[model samples]
Target: MITEDNDPRKGKRPDPRLGSGEAPDLGGFTMEDGTVTFDWTQTRVRLARLADAGPVELGRRRRFFVARDDLAGVKLEFVPPLVQAIPSTCQSLDEYLNWLPEGLGRHLIVLIQAGASALGLWEEDRLVAHKAIKKYVVRGHGKAQPTYLRSKGKSRYGSRLRLRNARSLLVETSEKIHEWRNESGPFSRVFYSCPVRIWSGFLDGKPAPPLSKEDLVKIPLDVARPCFDELLRVRRRSLVGRVRTLGDEER
Candidate 1:
């Protein structure tokens, strides 16, 4: 359970709808604080109780519930840990809730930007291995200068160099990821955020990382510079579940 002392929304004013006595139309409700989070253990317990007491609506990334009596119109939305993917076999809400993992298991995080990338292998909550790579793939202006850009002399030469370096970075990153997977057995999930422009290059490397389409879960939060510490921070945030209150209209 999240306490008021450490709640992400502690300093913000409580939503007025939460205090209003009128029955909220499903569409009339507003988002409350999302800082109210639950760990996997707490999440499973809470979901189980809700399933027993009321009906649940499931979505790809979230779940919804409404209670009876005084809580009839208040909707509760549950967000699961972003690092994990819900199994496709759970066709019913009960089955999905029952299948929730007791805790986060083995996973890999891959963060990539224009000229830098970071990788980390984690078991439960501990980061066992990590690697960070940097290369001169982007020009000083912060954009990737295309090798095909029609330019003269030095400008053209620089673009070609940057393009070559970019390819090298992709190959090296893919090799490292494959090596880690070999050494660590297998990762249950691979959470990654790579730019669209570089995604194809990474996947088409001479020896691409052995990542399955189903197991490739994208990191949902905005990340800063890729580094070892940033990987740890992302892992912590991924374990936290965000809550939003919906109105009857949301049903």
Candidate 2:
């Protein structure tokens, strides 16, 4: 009958076995009656702060949480380089989905940019498929845009060029998504992290494809590097079936 509080060992180190896959600790949850719930409130706050911190600060915070008494038995589960929450406005995405009736969706993690996109087909927290868009232009740089402005159709012509680029980018992205579905998709929803302005352009611009209910999560474009690193980490860790597993736009 070990309770959450009152332990004299308030900052003991976690068990090394907790993350070795030999009886790994997957954190903990509370169950009352037949319902199970995880207290993500504090975890979400911690994650938000971590998302804004630098490498040195991140390490400091990680070490702090790793010694909490409440997390003593499961500290390793939430630590960085494992599976971090990576703060999002959609922090409650998974929780909201859990409230649905049933069979409504699957987990999908996407990292998007104006120039590229990465899609991950996740089964729960495990990534089952990976897809990417190399270099698609919504709008080009320098001479990529026409230098000459015709007197007759200058504005209209420029609009058409932009639209053309947008459509091309959209078509390529949709094709990849469609291929994923055809191969093994029909995903329930997408937890996407992309620049806010770029995403808005994609959605608001004409000839855009439709998205499902509450799918996109607008994260700053600066987070792309760290996000990609996190994805690679997950992929490498998943190789063993056991192992373990943002920034910039605010200026």
Candidate 3:
């Protein structure tokens, strides 16, 4: 009959600061329901100071989060004004901060699945250009289904056609992306959600988009079927910052 507090399996909470050593004196912040959020304009200065101080731990290279040792139970997370690559953990706080844009800039968003994709370029918060591409890449009746490469029945011919179209879709997607960048100028960042299976084909296009791996930030949220409206929803959500506090088990 071990009580909840007496459970031996539960260890003491680890410092939320991610063990950067000594804790700083962050006394005024509060976490409601283990989380909080801050607006970019209001908190940028305060965030800069926290990053400059010592004994901080970074959570992830993408969708960056930082916690100072002094703030033992709370973590400060950053959401890019739009989707963008974040500096790696190896980089210094100054370098990380420098990577963040002072204000929103033009960015590209690409949502891709087996048979469909949506691409859009945005300036500030306004969508400037967008395109949606779809193809018959799926076999049978299901939506966005992949072709069965080894089918032995009459579906085999259809499967092969689907596979070929899938490849073509990737090439078309890449070409369109390239065209947009050429007409609109370089994008500050590229946010994409391309599946691993098609990633090589996506990049192998003869005139692929001028995207560098370092500048690509994978979309972190689940997206429904690729469409222009879905792109707008994702863009809006990416700009909001979220803060989370560690629970006993999490710490």
TM-score of 3: 0.73
Span of 10 residues, lowest total lDDT, candidate 1: 21-30
Q: Which digits, one per residue and each the tens of the lDDT, describe model 2 over residues 1-251?
A: 33223323323423321222232222233323222122222344333433334211222322212211232222211332212222323223244223322221344556655556666665543456676665423334432222222223445655566546645654666666666666775665655565566566556644453465555433322344324455543333222111111112311
Candidate 3, 1-251: lDDT as tens digits: 43222434324322221332332232223344544433344335655656665344555554554654454434445443334345444365466666666655777889998888998887765677788988888655663435344344444566767877887788888888878878888877788887776666678666666898777877777788888777766765565454555554554
Sort all candidates by TM-score, best to worst.
1, 3, 2
Q: What does the lDDT read for residue 187 in candidate 1?
A: 79
What Cα-based lDDT does every candidate model obtain? 0.65, 0.40, 0.62
lDDT tens string, model 1, 178-222?
888898787788889887767777887788878887778777778
Once model 1 is optimally superposed onto the true structure by TM-score, how far is the C-alpha of residue 172 displaced, in angstroms? 1.5
| Per-model TM against the reference | 0.77, 0.41, 0.73
lDDT: worst 10-residue window of model 2:
238-247
lDDT of 3: 0.62
Off by over 4 Å in 3: 1-32, 40-43, 49-55, 69-85, 141-147, 150-156
**For model 3, the run of ten residues with the poorest summed lDDT:** 13-22
In candidate 3, which residue pairs clash?
A: 23-69, 23-70, 24-70
